[model samples]
Target: MNTISAKYKKDFNMDKSIEEKLVIRNKRFQSRLMLGTGKYRNIKEAVESIEKSEASIITVAVRKIEYLKKIGKSNLIDFLDWNKLWLLPNTAGCQTAEEAVRLATLGIEMNKKLGQLENNFVKLEVISDSKYLLPDPIGTLKAAEYLVKRNFTVLPYIYPDPILAKQLEEIGCHTIMPLGSPIGSGQGLQNFYNIKVIIENTKVPIIVDAGIGQASEANAAMEIGASGILLNTAIAKSGQPKLMAEAMKLSVISGRKCYTSGIMTKQIQGQASSPYYGIPKLQ
Candidate 1:
């Protein structure tokens, strides 16, 4: 692996390296950057940011908005182009399996109403901790099992635990989203080693979600072999969300290129760029 890594590092190039596409639940996507439809200044800015990001998948928190919209209320879906993007409804505030399962069912119906023609894909976020907004692994596992049995493509947001990731994969989860840090903290890859293990071991796509502070952080995650990244705070909280979104787009591209091209291994001893025999001694 070290030798391969060295060769790849030597051959790395932004334009010359071949890039790998992301595939989730049998669906192929050109862009691996997934954005959340929350925390923007407004719907217009959110839409513009998403457009700039060029993300094919956007996660929407399923809550009262769907219920209100059923009665002809103005909701967020009205402002989005469902045809151009895939909506991944998440049980953002659900604290239990029952709640997540229920919301997921409602989310599927909502997607249908919005003209989604694909499988009912849901991002399972069972957050029992309101303080840190961390996921409840028990609730997430329970909800994932139920959703998979119901033929929904389950993607659980979880901690960076390889065992838990493998468990979710065994339960038929479409993808595994491990947090880089606490949700919305912008701490950026605090659990990098665990995430790298998850990416290496899991057959399913591993998407690093939450706690990415900047576009460079996103690039770092991608370079370490994460299949994709799902972020909102990094872009939404920036001074210029649109430009930040574009930076994120390029970051993902560059990071994926580096990953595909193979990064160089670190060494304790330094290697000389100029050969000793070729250099003339200074007078």
Candidate 2:
């Protein structure tokens, strides 16, 4: 490690080789992973984790904060500190189509006041029941079609079914996010085969959101051709959140490299990688 580091440093600066460039939906990013802003200890800690994660898109909810609301800053947004992150306000906690649309519109209005949003698109979360808070596929489909008509780049979160993914794309969504498990479950890649099918079939970006317990899980998702991942509790709840964030970033990169390189095909018959008789080659 020391020898390689010294040699690389002598040839070219080591610090400059670390940072990577990422792009999504024509927006440039230094990282591919997107982090959710809920469940953080505080706004400061949230920002710290985001920085450490190197996530390009930061998912936030459109709910109002009463304290900030009384002072005419109802959304509790801090645009000044979030210059590097793309604001992806989600329609979280919305049980109905009307409610989700209103929240999406409100997010646009609030962020417009901040005056520097990179884009006007939003990440839509249309959850029906309050218990598990799982997404309503029917409601999500309806909302996505509507949002597309409204010229918004709708990124809809849904179950791991491919029919829903195709339906969302037909309805004009920019991306489809399927949960690996339930929200905040951290079970990690329970539906890997279906996810693989989705990646093989779909044209739009397929992101594996939720249920990623650790960096390895995220890496596996990337290796299977997922466009991106959304994580919050896994990092925020960890003892060393910032360190975990960096580890996740590297995992995604390595996984992506393997994905592009193409994995070796599996076989039913027994096959050996090593030569059976290495000394026979000398003859």
Candidate 3:
């Protein structure tokens, strides 16, 4: 298995020479992996994992941060270095378009407090389902349209629906984030076909968010032409969050390299790698 994998990689020339940048609106990022500051054992572990992941963009749940601030408690923002990381405040707990729009305003305030005075990036999520945690397309679209009109860089999290993805893009959304599966389910790209279609059809970045449980899954997402990935549970719930974070970072890079190098076409029958015309006759 190792030899075959090595040979395949060599044939594909999946090296680290390709230079690709993930551009969302005016912002450009070298690292395509985005991490979330939640579900960790503690703030220290979360910080360490994020550092190890080397993800330049980190998402924070706006509602949670607001709650912490109201209670006079330090939140994840207090520890993160804003100069090194860009805050992507998310509307995690919002169930309605109004609620999501309200939380997004709070996120702008939070960014200003963190010294990101000009930051307007938001991860729009309007989810009412507690069991599946699936995003509501109508609510998300409403919130996205409102936020975009307000000059916010909207990155709406939605189910892997190709049509909806294009709709958000048409409305001036910076990026379209389609879930791999249910949030925190770690099912790993259950909606692979839909996501692939979105990537093929969309002009903006297509980030695969949620349901990625391992580094390999992250790699697979990037390999399938996803512009980036936003994940949390896979690293936070791992026994060694820091190590897993690093693994995910490498996986994203490896996958991107593979994608740029060009993946081989699938074949039904095996073809001899060595030239059959040059074979010596055996007695």
- Backbone N/Cα/C clashes per model: 0, 0, 0
Query: On lDDT, who's better, 1 or 2?
Result: 1
Clashes of 3: 0
Instruction: Flag clash pairs in model 2.
Output: none
Q: Clashing residue pairs in candidate 1, if any?
A: none
Q: So what's the TM-score on candidate 2?
A: 0.84
Q: What is the C-alpha lDDT of each candidate?
A: 0.88, 0.79, 0.93
Deviating ranges (above 4 Å) for candidate 1: 1-17, 67-73, 278-283
Candidate number with greatest lDDT: 3
TM-score, per-candidate, Cα-based: 0.90, 0.84, 0.92
lDDT of 1 at 257: 83
**For candidate 1, which ten residues in a row score worst on lDDT?**
10-19
User: How do the residues 169-202 of candidate 2 rate in per-residue lDDT, one tens digit apiece?
Assistant: 8888878899988888888999899899888888
lDDT for model 1: 0.88
Pick out the ten consecutive residues of candidate 3 with the lowest summed lDDT: 11-20
Candidate 1 lDDT by residue in tens digits, 1-283: 4355654775553344355578887888879999997778887888889999999998888885666566887656678788888888888889999999999998888788778857599989899998998899888998999999989999899988899999999989989999999988999999999999999998899999999989899999999988899999889989999999999999988889889877899999999887699678899
Clashing pairs in 3: none
